[model samples]
Target: MPAASTGRRIRIRMSARAIDEPHRVASQLELLFDLTFVVAIAAVTAQFAHDSAEGHGLAGLVPFLQVFFAIWWAWMNFTWFASAYDTDDVVYRLLTMVQMGGVLVLAAGVPAAADHSDYRAVTFGYLIMRIGLVAQWLRAGADDAASRRTALRYAAGITFVQAGWVLRLVVSETGALPPSAQVPFFAALYVLELAVPRWAERTRPTNWHPHHIAERYGLFTIILLGESVLATSRGVEGVLGAAGAGSPLVVIAVSGLVLLFALWWLYFLAPAGDGLSDRRHRSYLWGYGHYGIFAALAALGAGLEVAVEQTGHDIDASPLAICYAVAIPVGVFLMLVWMVNASLLAKPVMRPAVILGCVTVILLLPLAAPQLGVAAVVAAIAASCVLLVILTIAPWTRRLQDGCPKP
Candidate 1:
């Protein structure tokens, strides 16, 4: 009886061990968090749509950039923190729930906040979310020295940046200075925000999980992809309902879908996660480089939404909007591809391809604008994807043949 009892205890211990370290989030949890971001993406998309529909032009672009940057920065910070110290403890779970609530609050205020004469409430809600993020970092710092150092550095940098953001909000709202003067001031502060972290990381580094970080980034990409699909669906449904023309809408939707799929394929085809996983310690560039990619992904979705709205309408869309949809994603995709290759191949063979791709796409734009409309521009985007696939696979295939490890 004593021996049997001891064996039962051992089994229970093993089961507890298994339960403690989850390699990935459960499907339900992923779905839940994803749903919250769905709300966020929808909110941002609505703001963009509203501005475009009103033909606000450059007036809308500035505020969209501001709000988009804030939202993206918040999401990026949370994802990195979770990647590092996601204990999956009950406390951690509860905190995440609070953060999610904060995201929803922030999302709800996005439109009003974008054009608000008094930006204090908007800044305050953002500040609250940042506080929650800072709390998470503080907790991590207290528990693990390495994580603590990283978290503290991150928290400090974020605090400094948020302070600047809040100050800008106050200045803008108070009418103490003209709005034009605020641009350069804000630009300088933005540069500082971008640079300070790089400096800090170089001077005082922290240990971050490579595979987990890679997966977290991949998850965010999936989130943006979800947004793209949503945008495409919204466009298709509206067109079919209004015009009752299924064929054109279907072609447009398929083009968007295919472009997204190709982007996904191109991203995974080169073994980015595995490359980063191998060199997780030296992955700061790979990690930081992804911010551009994330922005591009979100912008792509926004642009697609714009395209959908303008479809079959005689109203001429701005060159800026059309170029933005095609250009931003291509630029981001190229940069991401370059960064991944630099990380894995440990050299810069992808630069020429990126430059060539960019130049080609830019030259194609005017020709495409008059001749192609949204669908043709999308087709142009598809062509760019094809070029990228060729660029990516060519060298990778050569490397394999030369007896190099598959990157």
Candidate 2:
């Protein structure tokens, strides 16, 4: 029941989407699905920012990682699965909507998750999403002969890991698993969840479209970058509310936007579509590597919020710590994006020395906060990002002027 064209009418029966489908852009339904995740990511980032603002930045990392893993994993799983087998039927659309509702449920649990280490609501919401995805997999197994075993494996693996998650929640709630002990438990289940797709696709890989995959990732990247925009707007609001337009917070906000824009610019430079199309076997690593990338971008938003709050005397964190909060994520985002892009492309767009040098500069910039003030330091960090963009882009521009095509 595979469809040759992506824009075909909705089908009553389930089907596989063509692997080489031309111009196979993401559908409106998929965009709607992403909105729920925006809510979920915002909730998690806000909770983390609140913690960081209260000077609990390090201690807050645990719950942040846990909740963000659930959010990112659920989104990734559906994305790849839909790439392979989006039936676009009424039932399929409805099931996807159910996952959206689950994201809201998960979003509603962020505070309890971060403040109290309670995950009952979080687990319940994950269960809802897991149910929707599992049903999709079961249908895939029944309807698509070529990928039936793979689909069944995915369904079974997801079910097994999800049940483990529920059980972990139960034991934790019952005091059998203490808060201190929950980390290892969560780590164990997380490993299993990450392993599911690898184990499932061992024999029969799904016919996912490479260009479509790239486009989907680009859309999600924009969505994550929007967090930084929203976070910066909050900073701007605080500055205007407290010290009016002349406040130094305005500089921080402007610098933060520049830094985010540079990152977005850097991410799109790699020709991911061609690379993934040629090296499909490496898709697992390319996809898995993004965990760090996405996490860093979202964390950068929280760090930016923390930066703004610190300037306004709202957060109790040390000036240096707040500076590092911004610097560290910028460095990580730079390094991980470079690394992930290297794995995807034959030759990375940016040189290794340039990447290392920029990261080193970004990370060390925070140490000067006491002397130059946090605003100046953040502005310098943003300038470094702009420098990196220049370093990576100037060569392409020169090549184009020399009558050579830019890669």
Candidate 3:
């Protein structure tokens, strides 16, 4: 019915979706749009793995964060805008496809950005995406009187920031900036990018459906997790081809699979949909916090790949550094999840003791690598994750010996 109706609805002018509309959900076009990100994420993960395998993991950290911010922010900006004003018309679809093309452009530039610190291609790709988005905002402003001011505000802010992004390259090329100022320049633009939506929504928040937004974020999480599974497979295969099936890589492979599964299970347990429905005003914190969550998950995929490489002696990185690669991202992910839930959930999603304990144990597990070896430590990390799942399970079934958990 929606497929048929979208064609009919094409004739109607764009307008804000009703906040109380029943059965609001992601459209087919949205799913297709999300599929493009798989390539973007896979490119970023592969580049990170390359950097780590070459023993540049520490130095690669800054570029990794910078490149990932581009990917996450692009996807999120489109998501919220669509939640409020998706028309699914001919022009709308074409503009979205244009943004999808920009994602590919950005994905193609990840290597140059990471390896050489050259961001020309990345900046150009981001410019393409923002141009398409600006057009969308313009259309929304012209067609929907209720949201016109906010839409125009979004359009102007995005345009101005994109100009800054383009100019950042020219300024860097002239060698006018001190070496220490590079990151701060980037960070200033980041603050402006984050501030755009906040400034726009102060007058009247767009009519985004809470459930729809939650579903979109959940889908993106699955995409990242799926990418990790693929990265782990590639690493395990490399080890297998070289060392045969008898290698400890088999143990690492199995443990990684379990770790991915357990993390996936834990992510969906947050009840984000209900909470967002109840506390709409806290949306920015809950929404923006996922940047850390998504970035950590993407980096974890790269880390898992490096862990396999280190285990197989294919990489020159220290064993402890390799282990920390996996452990650090895992810890960050755990902490972010807990913090996001604490901010949004009506009831505490999990006992903090369980989360903090698992994080402490997970981080320290790598210290045992000297005695237990990398495979054993990886398995221990996976086991600790499973333990977290077990403790948090059936929380409603009964109170624990620890007494009632914090709200």
Candidate 4:
């Protein structure tokens, strides 16, 4: 009887530990929640494409950046929460459902949220989502003392930042503040938002599953890539339909497809998860750096959609459009390379590759403006991609050789 009791205790302990694992098979409900983000991505991309095509592209950037940050921030908050305290109990799962509903409402408000008359509805929805996050953190703090303190810190920091957001929205709606002042105010709040995690980690470092965080990030990357492909397909189909079904536009579209695939390959070749698993100290750099990367990827897709719209049209595509399309992807690709090098290899050689790629794309911009056109611009992007692919593989080769026994 004693042996049986001991076995039961062991099973219970193991089960409890498994619940705390970050990558613990996310519940089916969590997966369903993630699906809503697909709509969010599509909505953001659509707004970007529409604004760019209508010559209001610059106007769209602020809203796009704001929306992107909000969505990314929400995801990051939940990822860390799940990493530490994914109970997978009925209560936990139900709270996740509530958050998922909040995301949908937030997404639905995107179109008008940018220029809402009051900004109250959008702010309220966003606040609700954030409140859900705070609740999770509070729960963690209550369940475990170490985690509880950490959770309390997170809740405090995040709640403080959300209050700032609400105030900014109110000021924006009221027009009591100058436009220039608004950005600086929000910028200061952003700095605080970023600093909070570092502060919390210092005081009471939360136990996060490195592998789980890595996998969750990987899934997000795949979602961004899938959006790119979807944009490419829609762009190509529309261009082909308009251009007599056998135009060079199809070629441009195919080239864009290949370029996206190559960029995706470049991202995954570095073995980021393996490197990060053992070096939890680098999590801050890795996590924050991805924000820019994700924005760039989404913007790249939007730019590509614009390129497709201009294909075979009499309206001469501006150098800026072509440059924007090429530059965004190159920038994203380089950022990924830099992050990996910084996090894993502790080298800066990737900087030169990025500089070279940027210079190449910029030099090609004028040439593409009114003469070389979309196809040529895309070819230049592909060339830059090829250069990056070569750079990505070279270090791995050297590492492998170094690992081998002396001859």
TM-score of each: 0.80, 0.96, 0.95, 0.85
Worst 10 residues of 4 by lDDT: 7-16
Q: Candidate 1 on 52-156: residue-level lDDT in tens?
A: 655664566666666666666667667656654555554555666776776787777777855663456556767877887877767766766544555578678
Model 1 ranges off by over 4 Å:
1-31, 115-118, 145-156, 195-204, 277-282, 314-324, 347-351, 394-407
TM-score of 3: 0.95
- How many clashes in each structure? 1, 0, 0, 1
Count of backbone collisions in candidate 4: 1
Summarize candidate 2's per-residue lDDT along 55-124 as a digit string, tens digits: 8989998899889999999999999998988878767887898899899999999999999888988999
Return model 3's CA RMSD, one decimal: 2.5
Alpha-carbon lDDT, every model: 0.64, 0.88, 0.88, 0.69
Question: lDDT value for candidate 3?
Answer: 0.88
Q: For all the candidates, what are their Cα RMSDs to the real structure?
A: 5.9, 2.0, 2.5, 4.9
In angstroms, the error of model 4 at 327 is 2.2
Clashing pairs in 4: 141-148
lDDT of 1: 0.64
Ranking by TM-score: 2, 3, 4, 1
**Candidate with maximal TM-score:** 2
